[model samples]
Target: WNKLPLAVQTTESLAGSNLWDVPTSHLHPSTNFSSKLFWEPQCQTQLRHLQDRTRITATIPPRLDGHWVSSRCEVRAGPEFLTRSYIFYPTRLFKAFQHYYCDSNCHVPAYSLIIQGKLRLRQASWITHGATEAEHNLQKVTLVIHNQWAAHRLETRLPSSCLRLGSGVQLVPSKLYELFNAKAKRDCLGALHFSMMELDLLRLEIQYHPLHQPSKELFLGDVHTDQNQRAHYRPTGYQQPLQNTMHHIHPCPVCALMYQSSEQSPPILPPSWSIPLNLNGHWISQRCEARPAVLFLTRLFVFNEEHHTWEGTYHHYSDPMCNHRTFTLVASGHYARMEPSSKVQGATELVFKVIRAKVTMFEQTMLQMLNSSEEGSCGQAGGWEPGAEQDITWTAGCGMLGILLPHKEYELFKMEKDHKNRSLLLIGERPTDGSSPDRPVKRPTSFQTPMVQCSPDTAVPQHYSSRSDVSTGPEVSSAIIHHSVFSIFLIVN
Candidate 1:
């Protein structure tokens, strides 16, 4: 015991003092203490002597009670530097402390020591710091121990020296100091150096539960260091499954009716007149026109297959000179397929309704256009009257004939389906009526050339068209019926 280091002696003395002063009454409440026993000097002296004897006979080793994970390690020899990393799984360290009698004599006290499991090295590699002369000579070495096993026993006197023992030491040339005589010289290696080392462990957390289940356990937190000290356990690489549920699902009543109707009896038409499977989707025009000088036109069609109706909204825009004027003409109606006879063939009729036929225009454009009109017809003062500026609004009714009248029948045609590309082509045309000489000789055409399918919830652009003078009222202007060619892509929900 005296041969041990000074630090070891001091630690043993502290442990002895704690043990001698521990209250037996606190440990066992039923036991009573005598007043004389507490105040007697001889009893105190005996307790101190027993503590000293116990300290001399027992040795306390480093505590290895928790789980540990390897993080990083570095080794150096003079100017040479090497580093290694490890991914350690959660491991438990079990320790056993045993006391052995010094001799066969019954009066002899027992000496205590800690017994631990053997540590086996699994892999090793040598690495160089930079491009130096050692790089060529120090090749990375990997050792494989198949069936053979080797264990090296280490006996450390001081637990505080565990860090130095874990690393290794070697002998080298060094100078020794002499107290009384002159200085002496010797060859030795300095203590081992751990330039960088880290050990981490897992941390556990407790959660509240109203009814605790036998098979369930509270979740533990992730691996982290506290005050440069590691923990005991950590989670593995496997992760728990997440919980999720769909929340936003609104079933459309019209779509449900369409499905039922299709299932009852399929519409009979020519093989070429293939109706789109999913028509309850949005469509946008491919080409936009800037007719009427200031007005820019865009056309959009929204077809509700379940309702058997479609709404076409035409968006009109003016140049920046008119404060970027904008308006809309919405024409909504029901569509029915014509019987596939030789007389009518593949034709569809869009029966226009007067339910909500209206035209919206910008206030600025309406004031300017009305001021230049011929007679006082549309309103009290031929239009918006002077001093009634607040009475002027953006929307006006169709009055008599609707905006999309006299041309309702559209010839429906289909192009070859490109199954490889998952697209279908459709073409529709409103034939020339030869009603007005100002009307364009060419027919009005619209198409979904290669309509690619998309999700139903996608947003489609709005359409706008400027009203022709003929549709406004019986007072006709020589404005030609411009053919609008709308190209739209379809998406089904």
Candidate 2:
């Protein structure tokens, strides 16, 4: 009880914090690459056995000769909220547009960058496993300020010469400057020497539909999660995917507007993490997701909108194929939904308080480790056993496992639908540092892996509340979301 520094504190309970330098987060989803069908990790051994039965065919690199637009607002390592629109030419030359926003979701307009470069598709990905590695050469970058407010916000980045053109005052939106000309006017666009969007290590993948219809996806190198190492860290993973406009089968109405958008006449692209009108339902991971920690996991969340209470279960695995069993963390909490964010339009802000949590062990290693712990240290010490679920609330959660009980998190949630109009939960990106966001200032601005909604028909226990005794078993049938087969939870509304 003495150690809970962030306990009982609401997001509104504190104030006076510095603004984020850049909300670029390393919260990214790992892929189960096969014909570009992306899914997260699934229930362990179950998914592993599916992978063992899977037969992979040689992959062909997708042609980079069309328009590609971000399906939704994308958040990178800095946890920066932005959108990308690109046009690739047959000659290998390309023009890319990056729209940066001010808030958590891409509601508030900041500025945009029109970048011209060249891309060359190369060998298969050595780092991304099944992805095709590629290279891109920087050519030029143009800055476009949305309005006076945008210019003022970006004033520090512009050189004095950019502000005064032959006179002492000039309109920033009207005049354009070379962000990285390498010849002149270097000071006009220094967004912390932002990795030029970190296009260095490139990978191109494709999403395959039922009829073998392939939608191209381009994955750029992930920027360093640490702000200090961002400018120099070589990308090993990928950022949020950009979809080829001509090929993408979209459920998003904004997809068309995205194709029509440009820096000069940019469309008001809505938040990809849109919040659903109704929240009384079950949301489960449609696919097992890969974590930067090399852990495969899935999450099941049930929310009672009227009561503002929620329950969540996390299934973690040890292998890439998710065949190895790990421990499960079950948590319950209450959420306070706030009004729309002034900083990010259409984005809902909320605070989630974790009232209790339980831990379930599935393997002997976990049992042995917990059994060897000192008395009253980690979950009742010697009482831990295989396949046993224990309440970690008394000890304020397992310190070794990073689970803090009676905890509160300043979380951001947004929702979107797929081609079939299935709901997806796009929650705030977890911090790269693995710490809970206890303050409103520390709340995430961007999203991580999306959770698919379970149809209302999916049976939810009537007794479910913010209580204990949650069943730790498969909630859905087996399905092929990846090249690897993983158990998925999905039902019709």
Candidate 3:
């Protein structure tokens, strides 16, 4: 290990110490422990496989707890390796609920809103009966789903659980609008609004949005069907009972009715590397016994939420007469076409390319923002004293949204203004997408000991504890909120 690349070896043994009460790391050319390590040729094979990209599709197998399980495959130069990775399905996550299978690869945007002011809804929950003035104030009602991936897309509505002021009396729609329009208090809002809301609210208004894509479009299909089929499935015609979870533009019920009445058939799959191999899709999965099951060699049908129907796709592998083709309805109603090994390989490549492109764009955007901020500061008359000015650029991928850029060799992020001391996470920038544009870089500066104050949202008693805690009752037009110092600071600074 010591004789290998310096960076690789250093990463391998970062836990041990060479001296008392202190840890030590050796350089690549260092001979201190060269003789102690032995290199193995067999390990190289496994390492190479680890570096290759493997694609896994989420599926429900009857053999398991119905949670999502993934079947992954990777093609190597010498031999092919197929593996099964366990995944937690979205539907199974909820208690006693049938969850919709969302496309893991699809970029679903989400956002969250934190209420910094007094919550009138808290008291409104007590009104479980008749329609009253509070129930009529629709403008004050705000129901936003806080999906972390996309924060900008928010839906204004009332949660079902909200206690109505009166039975059969609906709250005024205007109140819902006021809730979201409420001022940003202490920047405490970091919430998620799911993709479903974006599609339903904006599909008619905007040309395209994420939720508008039918589940079938993302499922097994050709390029033409994938691009244009979303329109065939309309939200207005769906028969499925509309619910918060059913925010996805639904499929046509007429098609679903036809599918329900049609004869059931088994899925025909492409060739498999070996016997007993498993194949799967976003919502379906199949396992073959001996010579890749012939049942999987033909056509398979999948449920389309957009058109409220079922659609079938044909899958084939070369074998002359195609005698290997056979269809088996292992499970009634839900079926997936057996995918060709070659097609699977192609899908994996496309997924990787999309992810890489998005990441690259994120990095570039962050760098530009950081550099622009610094340039604006440097353009000032004093130009910045040497070493007195500092800039740090960084990226935050977890707990927060959006990719961050490097600032002064370090990345920075502003946390949700809440109980946690509003400190920033500083991480150094590594290689991202490509080279960043040059800018007037600022030098690092020492900060005199600065006192940290608790943010207003955090200083006050914690309001939201869990998803269940959200109010579902009579509407409260507005809340009386104390002025948060941070809110003032953010505006003034």
Candidate 4:
């Protein structure tokens, strides 16, 4: 008896320590000590013996109640010291619900249990003792559980480590376990498996398991505290009461009809044109003869190709300065394409009708009139009333011309090479003789002609010829007979 370990003395010393206190009522009759301390080791031994006979009941912690994912895993064959690395891919855990058991008083926390997540083994390798060769390779082993428990284990097989018992199982120090718990917030849970490498060492394997379902289930037990400071448990299955199984809710007919209508309806597409006109720009005409002096007609043409309509404003300057010595005209009308004339092959012409035309004074001109006391002097000069219709002829090829009011024409000889520039030269002109409207007087051939290079202060020299013999005949009129004789040049800044 003396050689035997003093279990009774050890328990008495334990009770005397402040770490744990034993109640007098729980003392053993023979030893006069707490029965809990005396029988604890024996009970544990019996539990281990029972665990060997039957599979241990795995308990889950509330913290490990989510999904996990894994990319790599370590595989060790039996008896072999070598560990091989392989891809674990991913796994899923769904419908994880945890519950904690409580005493009758429900005061002390007891075992925690969880039923969630499916365990699937992708590959497993087993090697023979003293051999590096693998004995067998198992693949696609799925452990299906309608409701399973989670076992908490503290791995301490590593050198200089502490073991922790959680949820009725021993937990070991493992890097894989730490990683699994670290990502709990992201709902990703990891699984770490251990195989015996030696008598005292363990080989750790890690794999990632993601959550399969988004829905979560939570179970809570009602608790009450008594005067003795002990907790009592009231079991409850689910937070919400289940509905009647006989009746099933059906979807609304109106909602189904609306969804069907929305699904079957086609989306609206925008209207488009094949040959959209690029006429929304500014066009300036060459300096030519006008009412009072040689002037340049600068027009800003704004066209809506979608609407097939155009509006523009034109400024006629007697001098290139355009300071107070300019006339302004506003007009709007619809335009259409005309058939190409045989006389000028490949030339595209547009028929423009001035549905509304109003001549207004330029700001500089108005200001000059106010300053010079010549207000009424420019009142009736070259100004037209609103809503007045005018017919003009537009010929476009090597050059563009807008023949306005019979003999008066605005010619734009220099067009910007870039279609985006939207600029053209305006040359104002008038017929020298009575010929067909299409066969009006031609421009001078010489580029240095005074009419072609008219300056602001310099008067055009009359000696410079303004006409060229480019066939002044009635045949040109017949070629363009199908088109309306209207033209306007627009210049956009």
Candidate 5:
């Protein structure tokens, strides 16, 4: 026992310290306390397995007095149980000690798994959807399992105020994609629902309960009676099953082409009716070791404004041994094109915008007059049109209209399902002040006052033409216009 591994020795001594087998002598300060692993290694193995698998199916041993720790005894009889069926009561000291051990084992990965026969959240029950396994980066001294509640139950239903739909606020389509991605990572059910009036909150939570009914067990832990009962982790508020819950799972090109060739398919419309401007692309790259990811691609979709419809696809791959890549489609114009490709990386804009009539007219007039070109080389699409089909379109549907709001409200953003659920949130009515003609308007969060467009009675470029025109009624000139050369020229005059 004295020659055993230091960790094993210490653990055994701690467990056996109260025993009468110790020699009757003044306790030696130099006694070998490190040889502690002599007791059953079952506890160690179970702890290690629970940590690695992200699940708790450990077998509990009998106590030294030949009795069991009530709640833990039943867990040993049958592991496949729920609520009070399986519990892990690691003392706070044990977790604190694990911190140093985890640091020393810098490269090791940590996983926590909780498996049961049936899982229930809200009114829905999932018989086969418990987490199979999870892996995490262990380099950090303390790791917080965010969205831990996902394994236990879904988020609480948000209050009625959160269901702000078609209130002129837009929910960025990209943000909804992200919410789904987080759901997959934590193995929690990610649900979003809205039908003009009903709503659901995006929720993430985690917890552990005993295997057996605690009615027979002695009381333990300092229970807080004054705590909010409503906050005690329960699913509330039901939603109708989504008609097209799998909205974004796309078929491969082969399948898409086969379907297209087999049927008399309609011509595919672009993202919007008007040609897009500000065509640009950007890239981001990151890497992780022994840690959970903070970002990943979750969903992709294409909005056909003409048809007022959306077709999309989804992917959920989150394993520590796997590599991740994300491709984003972003543009500003009448119709924002979400270009389709299997591998969406490193693809440049192959085609330029089509030529507008005004820009074409300007170019043709210059050529007919035989004047040297001043616009250098005009793209196929040239010249800006005020009120012409701007590249992006904002129709007045409930869900479509909410696309402009901040991402936090994605779960609350919903369109009417009875009719075609098109992009309800569309980009319409440029800042009418005529200041910075093509600039986009900024949306405010709950943190600040909302910005509104100038009313019909308010004057535009005329009233805001000079410093004297500044109004004290919480009205500030558009930031983009304030920095524009046109604004400076008008002010100087």
Candidate 6:
């Protein structure tokens, strides 16, 4: 806590009192999120096992007993789009509402699940530091189908054993009906192959604002990404975060609308955006993003409408808040014609290629590590210096950094606008397991967080370009090459 700001220290210290009891994985000088040790798939399970040996039950923080609402539509591994609204009682009784949607932006309502249970806080998590471990038991489960379309969609997923899917599904428009009740012993979850156990794992993150309102974010256990592995897998990561209602100030006004409209009926979510006629502009991440494998990053992209060319700059950091710089990956390429996605209703599909790749080391340690790598593995034999950009397109990608040089990726894109009228670019979700979406069958069904386009569109030199395997878009202004002045120009400044 001492490493955080004074505001965080004042409030968070009062909540826990004992700073030593909390897990601070990245706070130590020796801890490096950039290292291979931190991102390994088995590292999370290993940390949990070690922490469980010395586990001790702790009291649930008083501030946790309140209403929490989703700040945005969340995408799970099953590519499920949903919104979560939950309340925690002082008596340890909990009620959670999950509103499912057909589209990634949550415009099309599907159905809703109401889950009531008893939650017990157990211990601190060693994996997602500053989070607590908890267990829960389901008392009741209620499913409310929103419309005929939603009912039809659910019916397709039900196994043959669950023949009760059709009886109560036929309904009038603009009405909600209970399709399944725990008291009825429908065995719907077993038949549908779904589990609500993802709710038991909990993490509370407090964002402090000394001058104004401070807010807390709730991170539930992540749902298994693979549909088949979901039933038995315990969540290791987290889904999208939720903002609290009572002890609240998350800066997103929609959070309140979600809580209010969730009372009687499903809220008609406003500001539903579509792909713009022209996507030629500069788009940047609105905030620092935390992803799987303990990686934290922010992306900046420049697109030219006249040429249909795109350049993406990825800035990687070691800290959760994007305060500590580690390295930068520069990928430049062009996209082909975007066809309407057959799988996802509103998303557009295209292919992105990385004609050239460059890496820039931000720390002296990173430079030394790259210089020590075997010849042609990371880059050239020597001369690796911090801030000096080096081309790694020939060796495919920087081996030391674990970056892959896939020939092309089937990317999905959607254009959206926020309530504030800011243009947003939504890209396909990269596989969390560190695999490339090179094949058509591997195209993403869900989208990542929307990137806000820079207002008035900043101007950058148009030289960097990546060539797609199947060229279908407008002709390029220049030939695609690995070594170009544009690549250096983009990374240096």
Q: What tens digits encode model 2's per-residue C-alpha lDDT throughout 1-493?
A: 1222221111101122211011111000221111111122222232332334132121224455788788766665455677888888989898988888766556666788888878776544333333345667677788788778878767655665643446555447746756765455344444545654356555454444556566666666655555666666655445666777876754656568788877876657654545554556667654345443223566666667756766666665543233344556666667888766554445577888876667777655456766887776668998987656788777876655555567777766766666576777777665444455778887766566676666442223332212112223222111111111111111100
Candidate closest to the true structure, highest lDDT: 6
Ranking by lDDT: 6, 2, 1, 4, 3, 5
Model 6, range 383-415, lDDT digits (tens) per residue?
A: 787656788877877656655564577777777
Which has the higher TM-score value, candidate number 1 or candidate number 3?
1
lDDT of 4 by residue, 1-493 (tens): 2332222111011123221222221111221111011112322243233223112111111112232211101011110111111111234233221112121111222222122233222111111000011111222111111112212211222111221225445432111122112124321111222211110100111111133212221112111111121112221110111111111112112122222211112111111111222443322222121220122233334444445454444554322112222334554555555443222212234444444343433323232332343222323323323222122222111011222321222121221222222232222122211111232223211011011111111111111111112111112121121111122222111
Which lDDT tens digits does candidate 1 get at residues 1-493?
1332222111111222321211111012222211111212322232233223222211121122222211111111121111111111223222222212212111121222222222211111011000001001111111111111100111122222422324454211121111111122211111221111112111111112235311111111111112122122221110111100111012212122212211112111112323434445544332222221112344444455555555554444332111122444444445544333232122232232322323444334344555454442222234543223211112332211112222233333233323243333333322212121113222122222223222232222232222221112111111221111111101100
Q: Could you say which candidate leads in TM-score?
A: 6
Query: TM-scores across all candidates?
Result: 0.27, 0.67, 0.15, 0.22, 0.15, 0.71
Cα lDDT tens digits for candidate 3, 421-442: 2321111111111121122121
Which one wins by lDDT: 1 or 6?
A: 6
Model 1 alpha-carbon drift over 4 Å, by segment: 1-278, 289-296, 317-326, 340-355, 363-367, 370-427, 430-493
lDDT over C-alpha atoms for residue 5 of model 1:
27
lDDT of 6 at 477: 20
Q: Can you write out model 5's per-residue Cα lDDT over 1-493, one digit (the tens) per residue?
A: 2332222111001122321112111112222211111212332232233223222111111001111111110000001110111122222011111100011111111111212111111211111011111111211111111132321221243222232334544332112211212223432211222111111111111112345211111111111111232123121111111111111112112222212210112112112211222211111111111111111112222233332222211111121111221111121112233342112111111111211111111112222321231232221123322212111112111121112211110100111111122112111111112222122112110010011111111110111000111111111122321222121111000
RMSD of 5: 31.5
- Runs off by more than 4 Å, candidate 2: 1-66, 75-81, 87-94, 101-110, 117-137, 161-167, 183-189, 196-205, 221-229, 232-238, 268-277, 318-326, 360-372, 380-391, 415-421, 457-493
Worst 10 residues of 5 by lDDT: 73-82
lDDT of 2: 0.56
Task: Name the TM-score of candidate 1.
Answer: 0.27
* Candidate with the larger lDDT of 4 and 6: 6
Alpha-carbon lDDT, every model: 0.24, 0.56, 0.18, 0.22, 0.17, 0.57
Off by over 4 Å in 4: 1-277, 281-293, 362-493
Q: Using alpha carbons, what is the TM-score of model 6? A: 0.71
